[model samples]
Each structure stands twice: as C-alpha cells, then as structure tokens.
Target chain A: MDHPITVDSDACTRCGICIEICPMGIIAQDGPDDLPGLVPGGAAVCSRCGHCEAVCPAGAVSARYPACGPQHLPGGSAAIAPADLAAYLRARRTVRRYREECVDRETVEALLDVVRFAPSGMNGQPVHWLVVHDPAEVRRLAGLAIAWMREASRAGHPMADLFGVLVRTWDAGVDQICRGAPHLVIAHADAKNPMAYTDSIIALTWLEVAAPSFGLGTCWAGFFQMAASASPALAEALGLPEGHAPQYAMALGYPAYRFPRVPGREPVRVTWR
Target chain B: MDHPITVDSDACTRCGICIEICPMGIIAQDGPDDLPGLVPGGAAVCSRCGHCEAVCPAGAVSARYPACGPQHLPGGSAAIAPADLAAYLRARRTVRRYREECVDRETVEALLDVVRFAPSGMNGQPVHWLVVHDPAEVRRLAGLAIAWMREASRAGHPMADLFGVLVRTWDAGVDQICRGAPHLVIAHADAKNPMAYTDSIIALTWLEVAAPSFGLGTCWAGFFQMAASASPALAEALGLPEGHAPQYAMALGYPAYRFPRVPGREPVRVTWR
Candidate 1:
C-alpha cells in the first residue's frame, strides 16, 4: 500500500522532525535536505498516530489516515496549573439533582469538540456520540428502560433483584433510571471493534472530567445503557447508527447544588513493584 | 440496619444542605433542631457518593464508607479555564522516546495523590496502582513479554503473527514491548469486580492526561499488557495483591523531545435524539 501521507514540496523546509518522531520509525530520509518518505511496508504497519504531521515545523507533512489532519491548539496564560487542575478534578460532584435549565447547543458542541481529542487505540477513534437534548425526551426514553427492567424482573433474570428495586423505585415516582437530568449522552461504537469499548469509555471519562469546568455535572446512566442493550424498543428510540451499539450513557445538566469540598475516598491500595 | 453515617450535633448548624443534596434522598431532618439522620434501609441504597459529607457547612457529617475524609481543595487563581484545559488535553503526546532518568519518588507520589480522585462506579474506588520504579526492572519485565511473544510465535498461537512482528521488532534493537520507558505504571483491581476494567482504565486515562502537566509523558503499554495476561511468570513478577488482575499499563518517563502541535483526528460523529 502507498503511504497515506503527503508532503508539500514548496512549503517543506525539510527539518526531518517527522522522521525522528514517527512512533513506528516509518518515515525516513536519505540525507538532511532530502524529503522524508515512508520506508518500505511502513504504510501497512503505521499506527496512524499523526506525530509526524503534529511535529512538523513548516506544515510540510500530513497524514491521510486521520482525514482531519492537525489542529490549531489554543495556548498561553489559559494553561492550567497542575495543582489547580487537581483541585478542580477533586472538587467535581456527581450531580443528580439538576436545575430546570437546558444546556445550550453551542455549549454541548464545545464540550464534544474538546472531547474529540481523547486518545484511542492506534488513534482509530471509533466512538460516536448520541445526545438526548430534550429533558422530556430523556424521561420518555428512561421510562422505556423502566419497562424493560419490569419485564426482566418478572422473567427471573439473574439481576432480577436489582431490576425489581429499580422498577419499584420508578413506581414510587422516583427516577432511579436517568436521575432526572436535563440531558443524556450515550457513547456508541461499532460492535465489532475490539478497542471500541475502551476508547468510548475513555472519551466519556474525558467528557465527565471536562464538564464541571463548563458549570455542568454528569451521572453514569447505567440503567439506561443496560436497557438499551437488552431492549430493542429502547435501542430503536436511541436511533444510533446502523452498526453501533450503546456502550454507556451519562446524565447531564446544570447542577442544583454546588459541592464546597472534595470528599475523601478509600485509602489507595497499591503495591510498588 | 443502622445508618453508616455519623453526625456530630454540636458541630452541626442544622443547615439541611445534606438532606437536600443526598443523591438517594436518604438524609433527613424531622425538625429545625434535629440533626440529620438516614432514613430506614437507606444504607443499602446509599450509592456512597459522599455528597452529604462533602457539602456539609460545619464538617459535621461523615460517611462510614470512604476511609479517607474530606480534602481541602486548592482553589482560586490556580483554577484553569475551559479553553486552556482543552488546549492542554489536546496538546498531549504519547511519548515513546524518553530521557534516561528516574522520576523522583516525591513527584510520582504527588501524581498518584491527584489521580486517586478519578471517579468510580457507586464510588467503589476499587482500582489499585503498581509502579515499576527501576528502569532495569522495567527492561526485565519487557524482556519477559518478548519471551512470551517469542514462545507464542513458535507455538503458533492465534495472535502469533502479531507476536512475530513484535518479537522481530525487539530483536531489531527496537524495544517495541515497553518502548524503553523507565517506569511502568499498572492499574489493577479485583478480578471479580464487574466495573474494575472500566474504572481502572478511567483512572489511568486520568494519569495519562495529568502527566504532561508534570513534564512527564506516557504511552499505553498494550504489548506488555497482552503478554502479562498470557504469561504467568510476568504476572508473578508484577507482585500485585491477591485477587487483583492487571487492567492496563502505561510507560512513563520524561520525554526526549516535545511536539509543537496537536495532531488532528476524524471529525466528531454524533446523532441527536
């Protein structure tokens, strides 16, 4: 296969940074001023991580695999200090109670735009997003999940006890399903990709970590995901792409309360090797 | 069952924030002077998120679940803006080439200290860390992984072809297994925990994202992990606690070079419901 890379001869200063930075050591040049090219069989083995395109000083190299090429990263005083970021991450609360306000479209777009940077296996980036924006629609889909749990409980599923509790809680007019949040975000991917599960979860974690900075909160929508996987009707309601399966979901909204301090955790269990 | 929470009445201001914020709606007060208490059967359904203890005004509420208590978060001018953080996350590189220097114990401890805050299912927080501090030890482990691949290739294992490439790469003086990284950070958890895999990956992603801030770099140790799971000797060498299995590993070290820009990715794919 031909190398999925292009070098702009006019713009190229031939710095050879791309040759040095490629993780697979695929790119090579015969001399300092020579234009770098992929070594024999390098195209087939390339992980498509784009380090070459990213490190190029003269905007000379481009990886065709990513399709989007390199991005213009915003920098300067806006950079976060390690201590401050640690504090921010620690102070994050799993918001279940939400104000009766909708997160605007632009803000959600911005959040996804940032989350697109989350890493993937060989940079395959197989994950996709399904956003349920309307709170009422979120509730409607959640009600379908409750119906699934009701059936599963009656059918003596192994998790019937848990399902029964969820069904009973729903009957009590309490939303134990989607947590009454204004929005629901689902990560989905092709069922066949081995890395799909890991990559999607990583991307969602990035989303969860970054949301608080935008004055938002998230709760893992475990019930919804389990139901979406088991119930055809719920999956139909999600309207995900043809081949994608729902991996997980998160409830999102403006938090009803602000957490003042970071709660503690179990003493970290570690064994240094 | 008695509630697992303890409240100090003398310190309690009766502000009722805990009652308002408990995700399970378990905490309650009967009167203006009454201290908050958990409703009957609340302990079983608490979810152990600790919002009550974290939100308390006078530090009066304490959850019995978390071994550690509330932490004083460093706030104010240190907090990062959304744009800056986006820049930081996007600009991160998976470092393969590393400077041959050991990261001091204090810095590694500080990084783990911050990483402990990564969220988990129902706040179970089951993930554990195994840090391989010595470079020679890391090389030894990598050699074991290569040995596993070499044997697998000879034995005609299903993944033998892939292992053949890795073994050949190692023989060619390219340390493809561990990439010559000085430290190997492994996240492990009880093999029985259903959420262990997801939670550990989330926590390690947090480590990878947070590392760049400390002038460190990380590359996912996929080859090493594949071998560790298949090679009992490598797993024994890790010396993880009983009942725990390695979920994932990452190679960590000071980067040999810095990339100037963020590589691009596929356009974000989404479906709005």
Candidate 2:
C-alpha cells in the first residue's frame, strides 16, 4: 500500500516517456521542464506494474512498490528479433527425458528471477514458487500424488480410470506423475481469486518457455497437480504458504536430448469477427 | 486415436534423437540401421507432444497425430541467448493507450501463426481463438460487457461494488472495459477440460509476449472476461463455439507509445524445498 513514485531531479530530462507509458494515465507533468508526479489518488489506482520506472530514459523515475528499483537494461536493447523469438518458441519441446544430474539451485533461482516478471491480473503477482530441489523429495511428492490417486480410484471417482493407470504405473516403477525429472516447480496462490489461477498458469508457462534458455526443460506435472488440488495430504506435504492452493506444477531438469526442429502443428483455428 | 509416428528411412541418420526425446520412451530401433518405430502399445501412451518430430536432426520423424507433419527448421537455431530472452521477457509491459490506426489483418494472422505453436495440456491444443477485428464491433462487445456488469450491480451480487465502478466508468465514456482497443482477441475452449482453462491462459500469455514483435500491444480484458464467463448473453454475443467457455480476453492495438525500459518488479519469492 505504501507505493512510492520517486524521481531523481538531477537526472530527469522531462522526456515524458514515463507519463505517456503509464497504463493508468496517472503520471503528470506541469510543464516541459517539470518532473512528472503521480496525479492525485494515483497510488490507489496504480497496479504497481512498474511501467513508469521501466520506461524512464534517464532511470530518473522509480516506482518503489516492491522497493527493488529498476535494473540496468543489459546490453542496451533486451529484445530478440520477433522472427527469432517465434522460432525459439516454436522449436521448444516438452522435455520428458531428463539427465539424472540435478540442476544446481542457483540456475533455477536465476530462471525464476526472470520468470517472476510474467504479467498478473492487476499486477497482483500473487503466484509464489515452490522448488523441490532434491530428487528424492520430488519422487516422494510424486508418491504422495499416487497415494491420493489410489484412494480416488478405490472410491470409483470419475477420474478413477486415469488414476488407476497412474497408480499402476507408479507400482511398475514408471513415473507417470513427475516424469522422473530431478526438479519440480510448483506455483501456488490464493485459491479464492479466480485471476490467481490463470495468473499462475501464465507464470508457469513463462517458466516452461524460459527454462530451455537455461539448458533446462519442463513438462507440466498434470497428475501431481490433480492430486495437489484434490488431496489434503498432498497439500500438507507441499507445505505451501497458508491460504495458498497449488495452481500448477512443472517437472524441470536438464534435458537428456535436444530438439533440432520446430514441428508442424494444427492449422490456426480462428473465427474472425 | 490413430496417432501414427513414422520415420523416413531415406532421411533418417539413425542418430536416435527421436528415440531419446520421446516422452513416452516408446520410440525404438533394434540397431543403428533400423528406422525408429513405436514399441508395442506405444500409441496408447503417446501424449502426442510431437517431440519425436521436433527433435529429429535428420527431419525424419513425423508424429502425424493431427495429420500435420514436420516443418522445416527455418534456420538452424532460432534460440535467443538465455540472457537476451530473459531481458526481453522482463521488458514486456501492458499497453493501455493505443494509436487510432488499426493493425492490419495480415499482421494478426502472422502473430497467430506463431502462437499456434504454444504448448498445451498433453498437446491437446484445445484453445481456439476469436478475434474481434472491427473497431465498432469491439466497442459494441465492450458495451455488452458493461451492460452485464450493470445488471450484476443491480442484482446486488458480491462483485456489484466493482461492477458498479466499471459500469459508472463506462457511462462516463472512459471505455474501461476494452480501453478503446481496435481489436479484441479471446481464447475459449471446452468447458469440461480444466486443462483448457490453463492452456488458454498460456496461449494468451504467448500472444501478449509476441504482440510487441508485431508492433502491437495487449492488455488483458479482465472486465470483459468476467462478464463473458458469468453472463450467458455475453457468451452468446461472443458466438464462441458450442460447449466452449471464454477462458480470457485481451485488448490489442498499436501502442500509443513505446516503453523505454523494463519496469522494476518484486523480488522472486520462493520456498526452496
């Protein structure tokens, strides 16, 4: 609630990029020479998305909502050409084959450092990450999910058939849950907020897309996510923050193989109005 | 599902990338000269993720699940260096202000062409797109969303307070719902599959990130999405395919201004297990 919009007067050039870039249109300048200030009640409307600070040419403006001010834009323009980005996204594959070697904590940390920038509704940024670093722990968590599915199957739940296969797979020493990945990343947020669910998915998708850049690959842990959402035991095992529900999970690790091409996909199904 | 994973004997170099990349671990070859084939009952377990086709260096494998074959890898590697990609993702911003000029149809199509490659649950790829191109139609849809909010406010719903503000803003001609955006892109999918909801969000997230490359910007149309989800009338107005629910909506247009820098964000919050 204590969102501060600060300006470095000596460095301010009054270019007004921050004012123009503000989504809420709340930043204002009295004159050409004037430093921009938040309009009356601007803080209340501010989503704390940080456009003002990010758009400032002189690094003169800082939206100190989180207290971490703007970072230096490394190597000037941080943009990948559009075509290159599209190709990168296209060429990405859901990595199921992961090397036994565990990814170091720092690499995962660095990846999340970038993924945390993924957009959230009203910039709520409610998604919090839970990284299961220990491979044994990841397997144990998968076991918890299997246990839940086993119970559900016994109860003749609607997903009983799916659960039966998963439990059977687990019994056979096949990991249909976490895909034998060395690391698992779970996104959790307030369960009551509808936006939180979508936001978490967006964040996880960003993590999945960005992981390959870090020599890591990720697969959505659908089975684990199913159990996490339904089983209190799994939730308790995760020990996520209070009042938070697991939104989704991703199995992450160094991929055992590399993808060389972008696959052909279903034609774009669009109904243009 | 008749998911045929075939390999071209002539083109295959027998490097075995496809076999290694298969998430199901079902792709096999008896010897170096043997062409890769599915193990017994492999098709039953195949997630249809197309990893075999994407990873094959010789462009020999084809997971023709949807009858789509492998696409040529445009150039060898389209990957942006990790640091550049991280910086690019970090620099993204939600654009509220828009230029009057409408984005060309071709640009939108090209953007979607790339977005079609976005990953989905089990490669289900259920997310379908509805693009509202005409500015007048976009405004009319916004009006309908406002009307829905007005009714909800009148009904004294729990969200009435927020809807009341949105309705009032609409009345003031401030265009809060669509933000006067010339185009609106919506992602809708089968309501029964919970994965579709998350997949839609991921697809839209990809769209948002890829938009700037097309010289456009997008803001999540939360207000419109809320109404689209709750009001049958709005859903009918959207004319989404039968049995489909609107997962989310995004307002798209040429940005009024360019953001010069990436905004500051909250420190990455993680619970390392």
Maximum-TM-score candidate: 1
lDDT of 1 by residue, B21-53 (tens): 886788888999998899888888887777888
Runs of candidate 2 exceeding 4 Å displacement: A1-3, A7-36, A39-41, A56-60, B1-3, B9-20, B24-36, B39-47, B65-67
Query: How much does each candidate deviate from the true structure in C-alpha RMSD?
Result: 2.3, 2.8
lDDT of 2 at A154: 97
Interface RMSD of 1: 2.0
Q: Report model 2's TM-score to 2 decimal places.
A: 0.91
Q: What share of the true interface contacts does candidate 1 keep?
A: 0.69
For each candidate, give its TM-score against the true structure. 0.94, 0.91
Model 1 misses residue B145 by how many Å? 1.1
Question: Tens digit of lDDT per residue, candidate 1, span A83-158?
Answer: 8777877787788788889999889988998898898887788989989998999999999999999998899899
Q: Report clash pairs, candidate 1.
A: none
